[model samples]
Target: MKKWKLGMIVAAAALSVVALAGCTAGKSSSGADDKNVTMWVHFSKEDPEGKAMVQNITAFNKENKKGYKATVQYIPRSGSGGGYEDKINAALNSNSLPDVLTLDGPNTAAYADSKIIQPLGKYITKKSDILPSIIDQGTYKGKLYAVGYSESGVGFYYNKKMFKDAGITEAELPTLDKPWTWDQFNAILKKLTEKYQGPAIDMQLSDHSEMAIYSLAPFVWSAGGNITNKAGTKAVGYFDSAATQSAFKEIQDMVKNGYTTISPKQKGFQTGKYAMLMSGSWTIQELDKQYKDISYGILPYPVSPKTKKLVSPTGSWQYAMSASTTKTAASGALIDFLSAKAQMYRTSMANTVLPARKSVSDEMMSKVTEPMRFLIKQNQESGHARPVLVKYPQVSRTFAETVTKATYYKENPDISALMKKQAQEIQQYLK
Candidate 1:
């Protein structure tokens, strides 16, 4: 991954300390004498779903009659890790980490490697029914250290009205069973561009050239190429291979040929300007609010022309217990509660994220709207999580940067040179 500018890293590190200091003022509910279990959560307390989670925790506390109660501290939603990383790092340095906390997928491995988090192996025995992929995402160095709360994946969001106006039927929109291949996807984009006078597609990468790499991950993975190897010690070399080059060239052609537009100020997919976009299931809530009349649906990202199978990037949030916590049983119990059958069901009701448990997801599918049901099904079958590694964030950033430079540079954007540089950087870091 690309290295952050020294200044940005220093600034983020400094801000993190201040953020943690600010959070220390909040009073704990577990009482001064009673052992307290603190939770670091990323969700905004002001959001209705976040409020519901607080209410649920309260209800759980009352019903369980556990002597110890928990207190949640909200992390600000700025910087990478949504400001939670800084708080976590501060807590780690001071050895004051909360009993439990939420972790981004990539960060889980890093924290686990640092030995600041406890492995959840014992706690997970009873919850063995959780999906293997979800469980795997929280594992690092052969130990299960975190429990996933929700699972998300990237997919294509198309405007149904645009399809209809183009005389493209619902049958034409790619589905799980009938996913679109690169050639087919390109054809569809071409058709949409020809039929619609507005912006055909919005890629949302204009300023930070590296940002497009995240948007193109599905394509790379679908093509059986990856930004990095499984072990995460080196960058993948296939990025400049003929197949991968052709795949990226298609994206460039889409932009240059008017089939796609790269914009910084564009609105969501619900707007008529773009017929389709690459996004995760998290957008369902906003889409429901913004485009009630337009029929929109999601499908797994199209497969690469070189590879026939569709692949989608896994996006998830994990719950982990802090190593410093004295109340292991209490914190473990809370993790169990979150992963329990009934509470897992609440994951869907309260936060639109897919449950970590398949059973809960099955039930959630039955209750949620049609579009969301499709999203859940796609997420279950095709989602691919980011690899767990200590240097994942850095690796991800590097990969994003390399792809962006290749796509936006005026002169020859030597993909081979970029890949070699990335590999050397990762190798040095690992050593």
Candidate 2:
């Protein structure tokens, strides 16, 4: 479960577009107008994680001893009213939203901006212990709107055999402290292209929908460019900046020089056709499960040689409360119970995720293997959350479409003109 495969439609915030689904539920028989604390999530009790959450909720309701028990409604995550965005929209329209709900990190701003959810800054019990990026992902316009129990990350998954065959030594590749510079990375990819029978790198174009923007963001940021201005009001100079253009040129060089392919012989890195894969840490599980003999290494994402700055994509699901809810106290209690250090650790370990809290991540990484440690270090040091703005959907989509269109079928694209067009389109959503 890529868990949060970000294939969302880039709809303007004012347009009311929702992507992804949660679960499905009918009104429980607690009396139609029951005022018990209520919550909604994207998961169901059918799974272990869901079951565990239910147990937690039950214990919390009983332990609080306030007679303010909570009920949860599950919405089908793949359907119209149940999909993440659709369900939230439906709930908003009918004013039937639960007192507490979950949101993806990037979507927190949209909800906060639209006044759909209220700030929960005071409820955060371990602000300093949590990953800085997690807090950043939940903050918008200077307010904390959400909190996440778990987190995910992207990394460079490489084939050890391919690297060895290319005459590349492990010491020469990217390390946590000293990752490959653009020139060094480019030179390696060139050599890797010759050794790799399939594609030099599995950029995973099939993931062009979300991965295109999410995973590729580090490059732009490392070069000191961004998808939007700090205020999130526009994208004029940020997306079209010289730093971004330079990153695009390197991407162009890789393509022009035959370092990648539109159609790789094999779609998977485990198949040994690709030398490197710019993918999520989930690939570790996939590797452990299959292709036992394939030697692989996980590397930190490369930085811009020009800026020499390091960065990596960071964000995941978060918890938020309804603005209209009268049960702020009860809702806050639920958030605390669900995101407690132990709870966060349980979910992170179960889902193979990096904990959003530094302490929890430290504990879990102590029990996990390989890339988890690497991911933990990187998440602490260089994790950069996407733009947390109401205009993020627009900005993200624009960056994805603009940058992808710039490089997809053509090389040496007029990146400046394309970015300007992107900036113009983005300004429409500023209001």
**Using TM-score as the measure, which candidate wins?**
2
lDDT of each: 0.70, 0.76
Q: Over the stretch 1-431, how does candidate 2's per-residue lDDT look in tens digits?
A: 34344333233332342322222332322344434778888876675557667777777777765566788876546633247668777767666677898887778887897898999988778688888888888888788889978877888888888788889997788787888888888788888876654357877654446567788888889999877788777677777789877776666666667776545556467777788888787778788878777787788888898788889888888888889887787788788778888778777877787788888876877699877788878877899988887766666777667656655646436766766777788777775
TM-score of candidate 1 versus the correct structure, residues matched by position: 0.83
Candidate 1, residues 240-320, lDDT tens digits: the string is: 445555556666666656766656336646666778877766778878887677677776677876667766666577789
- The parts of candidate 2 lying over 4 Å away from their true place are 1-35, 62-68, 79-82, 409-412
> Each candidate's TM vs. the true structure?
0.83, 0.87
- Regions more than 4 Å wrong, model 1: 1-36, 63-68, 79-83, 125-128, 197-199, 207-215, 236-247, 413-431
RMSD of each: 8.7, 10.0
Q: Which predicted model would earn the best lDDT?
A: 2
